[model samples]
Target: MPKVTFVQMDGAEHAVKVAAGTTVLEAAKANDLPMVGTCGGSMVCATCHVKICAADRARLPPPTEDEEDTLDLAFGVTADSRLGCQIELTDALEGIRIQLTSTM
Candidate 1:
């Protein structure tokens, strides 16, 4: 299992352990974290945007063009910005940490 940590706008954090194929958004939703998935993981909405912690950012897979396009509409976009719904959990991301922006 991989553990994904989500730090909300208020600094509160939630950690959820999930299977390798789970998406970050799915992990967040399963744990009742504050992430919003307006498109239900369709990659059409930026509501599930999150900033990947620098330490674990490199472990993630490169984002697809569609994900990159959606991230452009996200608030507080950073070099590590990613659409949670498009990020699948993997063994290398066992302790992945991400920061949730105020917009989502």
Candidate 2:
């Protein structure tokens, strides 16, 4: 399993362990974190937007074109922004940090 930490707007940290290959959005949902996957991880919506921590961003591959387009619809998008559903967990991603963002 890989551990992921979700940082809240208030700087609260919620750490959860998930199986490798589980998407970030799925990890959040399974742990009861406040994340929305309106399109059910189908890559059709940006409700699962999250920001990868600057230092950990290198652990992930670049977002796909479709993911980039959908992420444009999320509020507070940043240079490190990514749709949670598009990020699959891996042993290499253990201890990754992701910041929650608004669905709108």
Candidate 3:
């Protein structure tokens, strides 16, 4: 299992241990973290947008073209922006940290 931390807007940290095959969005949902995956991990809606911590960003796979296109429409987008559904957990990503892009 890999541990992930979701940083809330108010600076609260919610950490969970998830299976290697689980996506960030799925882990968040399973743990009752505050991330909205409006498109159900289809990469269609950018509602699951999150910002990978600088230390963890390099550990993730590069975003797909579809994810990149969709993320362009997300609020509070940044260089580290990524759709949570697009990030699969891995042992290499242990202690990964991400910030929810929006509460909604």
Full-model lDDT for every candidate = 0.84, 0.89, 0.88
Tens digits of per-residue lDDT for model 2 on 1-104?
A: 99889998789999888999999989999988889898999988789999987789887998899998998788888998999999999999999999998675
Clashes of each: 0, 0, 0
lDDT of 1 by residue, 1-104 (tens): 98778888888878778999998888888888888888999988799998986778777778888899888888888898999898899878887888887663
Per-candidate TM-score against the hidden true structure: 0.90, 0.95, 0.94
Q: Where is model 1 more than 4 Å wrong at Cα?
A: none
Instruction: Evaluate model 1: give its TM-score.
Output: 0.90
Candidate 2 or 3, higher lDDT? 2
* Model 3 lDDT per residue over 5-31, tens place: 889888999888899999989998999
Give candidate 2 regions above 4 Å deviation. Answer: none
Cα RMSD (angstroms) for every candidate in the order listed: 1.3, 0.9, 1.1
Q: Among all windows of ten consecutive residues in candidate 1, which has the lowest summed lDDT?
A: 95-104
User: Sorted on TM-score, highest at the top, how do the candidates line up?
Assistant: 2, 3, 1
> Which candidate number has the best TM-score?
2
